[model samples]
Target: MSQPSQRPEFPVHLLSSPAMIEACRERDFARIFTLARRAGMHNSLIARLCDMTASRVGEVISGTRQLRDMAVIERVSDGLRIPGHMLGLARRDWESASADPTAPTVDIAPAASGLVPTLPGADLDSILAVAAGPKLSPSTVRALHSSIEDYWRRDDEHGGEVLRPAVVGQLRYVVDLIKETGEGEYRRNLYGVAAELARLTGWTYFDARQYSQARTYFTEALHLAKAVDDRPFMANVLACMSLQATYEERPADAVALSTAAQDCARRQGATPRVMSMLSMREAFAHASMSNRSAAHSALAEAHTCFERISDQDPDPAWVSYFDETKLIVDTGIARGRLGEAEAAEPLVEEALRREPRGNHRGRAFHSFWLARIQLQRGNLDQACDTAASSLELASVVESERVSGHLREFHQQLAPFRKEPAAVAFETQLRATLR
Candidate 1:
């Protein structure tokens, strides 16, 4: 066979800086492609550099595909002359080789570091200056709150992977404002807003499975909430922590936190909707602990609380997401966890039917639970079909939670591996995961 000529390697000195890695980790493909092009690299060169197909490179650049796999990220670091640590990966061999021996090695840590890095257009000094300035106008505070509301809605439609960085930046800014402001109603309001923002940021981190980072943010949120004596917000944060514990399989912690949330909410006269959410968390914790009776009681309480929620009743913006649909989905999930597949099936199906098309993550989540129920019922073909649908939805969302559920669903299909439907589903799942 004739030998093919190797393409010339780009200058190692031209490699991207740490910022490029941050951009890549944030899924900012446009910035990466722009930088590569600015460096005189074409799609062909990028593909060659990353060891990807030319069309795949195009897809990545166009935002049709995200570079998530570690191997692909490492290849991109080498190809783009970027540092692996920027993408939250271990230091690549090329990075070490290209560095000066006398320079200290930077430990690659999770992107969710202790300090929130300065955003592109904002710096610590400038933000602190703004915070230290005379009282912020009500209009300015409202605008900031409105922006956070918009981000929350966007997060519902598009998963947290794309919004995490922005939320973190906003959170730090709000925290600065709260710290610099003097005691007043405005300061108290800012504290509340900061607490909510911290909770939202923590949620995004939790979705990404960055547990340590999530816990840090959640604890900050709780402290901020407590500082302003906002019991409702405090209860909400505790419930959020409970959800994290439930997901982490720390049932005892989940139960304790959820109970504390319920007590706080009750004392503060929180809305029925808020109480319902706390009850749901309690149910989930009980289910996790395999306490069927306690789980059922909590679920019943959740249902009662939800039923008391009137359409005209006032609801906190944060708790508005917990509608009947959410209640059903959560109840189904609790049942599914308790191995009550027969009872969980219809609830999950209804939740899926009512779920908005734009809520890709929710659809995938509910579908996975439905499929899990089907699998438990020994309906292999149905389970495979349902799981395949979930996998398709999962592929579109940038959510670690959805991806984890898909992975669990895949594992549950192992007993049916000999079946044709299972085989086909596995094939599609592997391709989707890739």
Candidate 2:
């Protein structure tokens, strides 16, 4: 067998105290490994410290995997001497206490918003200097933007729970860099990245059901986007807030926000993709408010805008995910909310078919909507089967939004409790819950 290739060495001085603490707090193994490598620690040494195989460490460093499991986080924390709050875990003794049969279960909340509390400028400068060491170059700033974009892609595939901490940590790091130095194009780019990152962080919090924190981040994102005059991104953030309002059943608030987003997009001459997305949210708000005529008109406008989109359009990176498939899905969902089951069914089915298998959360969400349509049509057996399938997919994902769908589906099945299929689904769902 061929011998394994040796890893290159990094300088230990590069792993600053701030970076290490932030990485540990976020439970970001990839960042920690990178910092360690820069600090001249070899893969084998890192593996030994974290009590894992070198290959496993490599996988994390490459962003191919994450450290989301609590037991693994605890183990790593213990081995690395990381603080408890940083890992969002209970005291170290809590694990040992679990060995006792009567030990109380520990209920640790997920890490807080990860927004560093503001300090006086002088104090902050001193603190960040210790962590960041030196001013970042334009190349380093570009790399950071690339990393944020990567986090966005990963969030699409894995759901918020898995990537929120790391993204927030990145946001914190970027904010620190902004405080350090930059001007002209460099300053503009940094502000734009920070705004986008804030929006993304808010989106993750929304998905995780932390509504208050989500709103706070979204508000801050809008402010930052406005500060940089990034109208398109600001519009996107407004649409995101609108979606959250719709989810919370605040139709008036949703309509107001979506309408604002539409106005912003139009003023900025945003790409058709952006306009389409804003229009779709507006349609959703109208539907929620039971204004059928307004909803249908908005949906038509959304379709018109979507049709105008081409590969050559100047789409922003933040709105790149808004393609035909997404438009179709949202249109179907808007119709479904308006009680147009016949109109919604085929659209949702098509969306489900077009959705890639790797998009587990998307598949689950679309499947649940399909099940709702089936139920609306009085096809209890079909509805039960479809919902069971959705629940199965939801079981494997860590998303509060998907769980909410499952709960709503269960409530819909209550009217058919006497049916064997309904009873069977209830059993399976209960088991999944446990």
Candidate 3:
């Protein structure tokens, strides 16, 4: 295998940290095998856990096969009950790098607006009035929450459309309860509910490329979460903020927010899933900064932590959707950063395969990353197609981060502006900008 240093033409964006790679090399192989034995998993089980053939694990243990891919690193972490973050970093160090030599160069042009119609002043007033109405029941508030979630799901799949007036009416009912109840345990729950809604709205707005509005909701949600003194939920708000930071190419800011979230989750006694999420955000920040070592290290650690999750402890309600499969999606994204599209593709594909319907947001992300992979592979037409699909899926939602990805994709496709597919995608994407 060619070491990272052996390739002078390698894209700096895909380089892993040399220090992190060396750390992985320094780990005692005998020690891992011993730990696996103690975990009660036979060699065959270990192989399966690592996504390798039966003999592969044996060779790895016997100094034949190398511990390289995130999958294999994850298996070792699982077999030894090691922390996922540690393993992820190691894997990052070992994976190969890839780049889009054929990617069309975009000019980083100024962003445009006017995707969805802005709600009129009178309509806004009416919605706010309904939201602050008297006598709204908890059941009603809960129902509104469910409705927003459903709308978000629909937007994710079919594309962006304003929530129906009826849905807005229901949201108004919930807001009324929060305003009237005015602070207590009941109000705290209501705030939590509202915080969740606002966060999702902000995410959707971000998707629609309404960056300013997305920030407004995020700030409001952060305040509400703080009032409720809900640390776990606060972590989510911080993650949203981190997403915005990443979008702005403020990698250092992203790293700080992600680290803060990790600390908050740790302080709140968060579960493995929560920790994994915090770690994943940190890895994303690292990747954006071209800090190959930190990115891989964070990924390895996340993978290890994920493997150790217990079925016994019920996960926190907000983070219940995070599972092994989602972790794989995160891993794939990290791998793509380290210039290993070939390795990253399969993991991303597997994550999508396992992802359930209504995960419109996740599908959008999968397609977005896949487009980047296509670009790297010199498949310009396919890349453009994937980007168009991603934009269509993403436009209806309120996520700045997703919209940022679209912006980046557009930039990557700039060089191919003469191509009909590229031009069409640009036209459709411009139409969706709010």
Candidate 4:
């Protein structure tokens, strides 16, 4: 019989740090090697873990080498126990798809409510038990979280058009589990997971431009999160609502929602990344209101929060996507909202240059903002090129939100309809989107 393959494990703290996240997103071998070395992994161990020679590992750490081959990257991911999606790869074999009772506990604050949660008896339990599988065990809850992460990856790459049903269905099942499971951590965590699924469901609806439905689901998510007192996720749901408010031209509501989110985040011990993310939403709200000083002040605070991030701060998986590149792009988007094209363009461009290869939806969204800034600056040719690039990226990602941005750009092009650059882009947009 073949021996079990050796799988080295790195500390979760090492894998989830912001620097490690950015390095993995950019596929910066040098930075990855350096981070591992700093985390106390010796050169030879790093070599053994990454399936590279000690010399190669040293060269990478010293910035004398780079890893570009996909096969080599996969080896590094498996060896270092890096989650595949961080590298833009598919979920690895190590990421189990099935739920077993022995899986690690799903992390959530235990419910303090003395009363346990249980359904008010219905025959539906017998009917759904087969599909629901074993009564919501720790392993099952962990699997649900893992599936949520996969759904996030899918939305990141391809948007949420098709994932909505699966998300909503799972949410229904989890809601049922909450009703059946009598109290304790299992039921509490189930509420939390249900909240996560509901939030993702709202996000999909928002992505598809179904604003009314999105609002309904977001509200549901907030209520569920409140049930378990999951403050961070509650704040996250509020931030989502705040962003949606900005889209709906409700700057006052946006500001209120973002402020509420920031307050919630501050009430409890939250990671710098979480605070930084909430601060950006506050900045966005201010930018929408054209409050330049306030927006910039918020942006500066966000940067300060980001700078305070350290290895000891264990950020939740949901906030992992808000890495340095995301912060820069979000900052640029806020500037764009404030009509500061001169300041926004370069920041967005730099972020795009560092963005990961597989984040098609994010690239599309960021490119749309960059295109808008260029148009605002009267750089017609550059704007058209940027918008065209955005269109190409959005073409692969199923997002009406992106399409809406492109449409907004096209509407702004009306005065320049006869301009060759504008004409070319308009033609391409119509041809591609149609």
Provide the clashing-pair count of each candidate structure: 2, 2, 36, 1
Compared with the true structure, the alpha-carbon lDDT of candidate 3 equals 0.64
Regions more than 4 Å wrong, model 2: 1-135
TM-score of 1: 0.72
Quick one: best TM-score, which candidate?
1
TM-score: model 3 vs. ground truth: 0.61
> Could you estimate the TM-score for every candidate?
0.72, 0.70, 0.61, 0.70
The 10 consecutive residues of candidate 1 with the worst lDDT sum are: 116-125
Clashing residue pairs, backbone N/CA/C < 3 A, model 2: 12-39, 25-86
Q: Can you write out model 4's per-residue Cα lDDT over 124-176, one digit (the tens) per residue?
A: 22222355365656789899999999999999899986776567667767775
Candidate 3, residue 272: Cα displacement in angstroms equals 1.3
lDDT string, candidate 2, 67-113, tens digits: 65344665665555443444553334323423322222332222233
Q: Is candidate 1 or candidate 3 better by lDDT?
A: 1
Give lDDT for model 4: 0.81
Runs with alpha carbons beyond 4 Å of true place in candidate 3: 1-123, 128-133, 136-141, 158-161, 164-172, 182-184, 357-361, 379-434
Better of 1 and 4 by TM-score: 1
Clashes of 3: 36
Measured with C-alpha atoms, the lDDT of residue 91 in candidate 2 is 34
Question: Per-residue CA lDDT of candidate 1, range 1-434, in tens?
Answer: 98998554434443336655456667576668766776677888888778888888788778787665434565676776565445553345555533533222532222232232221111112222344454577986887788878877777677876776566656666655555566788877887787888788778767776565567678878877887678888999999889889888799999999999999988878889999999999999999999999999999999999989887767788898898899999999999999999999999999998989988888887898899999998998999899999898888877777787777787777777888998999899889875
Question: What range of 10 consecutive residues in model 2 has the weakest lDDT sum?
Answer: 119-128
Query: What's the best-to-worst order under lDDT?
Result: 4, 1, 2, 3
**Higher TM-score: candidate 1 or 3?**
1
